[model samples]
Target: MKKIIALLFGALLLLADTEFAEPKPSIDNPRKIVFPITHGDDESINHVLSSANNVMKFYGPEKVMIAIICYSKGIRTLLKKEKKIAARVRSLMTYDVEFIACGNTMRTKNIKKEDLIEGVEIVTAGIVELVERDLKGWIYIRP
Candidate 1:
């Protein structure tokens, strides 16, 4: 009887371990986030960047991927000549936050490609990119 009980207990422990083991996150299936910054001012833009950085800090880079789409007046935030918020924007790159500028907005505002900050990539349209990201399960953030 003692031997049977011990064997059952060992089997139960093995079964529980397999059932309750924590599942690991897949790097290929990371969480997606998109921040659409349409504001031109320092306060709103900085708030958005700060909030994005906070999210990255809380979630860790391994589990989350971040993208910022700048369009319309928000394109002004990425001007290389404009030193304001440049450091903060640069810092986010280290956390894997990608900054995408709207090509249409650049042409509409008469801003040249050379005028944009170094790390920003030019997308066809900011709104279009955001929508595509939404389709791919990215959560939208407007701050």
Candidate 2:
């Protein structure tokens, strides 16, 4: 009976190890991602939205965090009249995506702080934010 109990215990240990085998890709945690949109065109905005959707699908919303920096002409994509893109932005926000706009651009373009559409945050400098994200190894896409 003693020998039998030892064999069973060893087998249980082996099974436990196999059941909790390490994951592939060897990641310590989910990767970081950032996208900068510098174009106000509808097509370009849609492209960024699509890319973000793909990332969320693969990584799961909670596992990945995305920051979209809008500066220059791209700030128009956050306007209330951008209905199509606005809807897409709303959908992405449900998954915790963040939209950042450049405060300097708003001043230069004479766009009021209140003029930005819902779900957008005004940042001090869009370019600086982009650079900081890049340094942290977040994937950068200009769409």
Top TM-score model: 1
Estimate TM-scores for all models.
0.79, 0.76
* Model 2 TM-score, 2 decimals: 0.76
Please provide, for model 1 over 8-97, each residue's C-alpha lDDT reduced to its tens digit, 9 standing for 90 to 100.
Answer: 999998887422223333366666889988989888788888889887876678777999999988887788877867777888888789
Q: What is the lDDT of candidate 2?
A: 0.81
RMSD vs true structure, all candidates:
10.7, 11.8
Model 1: which residue pairs collide? none
Report the error of model 1 at residue 96, Å: 1.5
* Model 2 Cα lDDT, one tens digit per residue, 1-143: 99999999999988874232234212355556898888888888888889989977876776677888889989987777777877888888888799989999999999886777777999889999999889987878765
Error of 2 at 133 (Å): 1.4
Give the residue spans of candidate 2 off by over 4 A. 1-28
Q: Pick the candidate with the highest lDDT.
A: 1
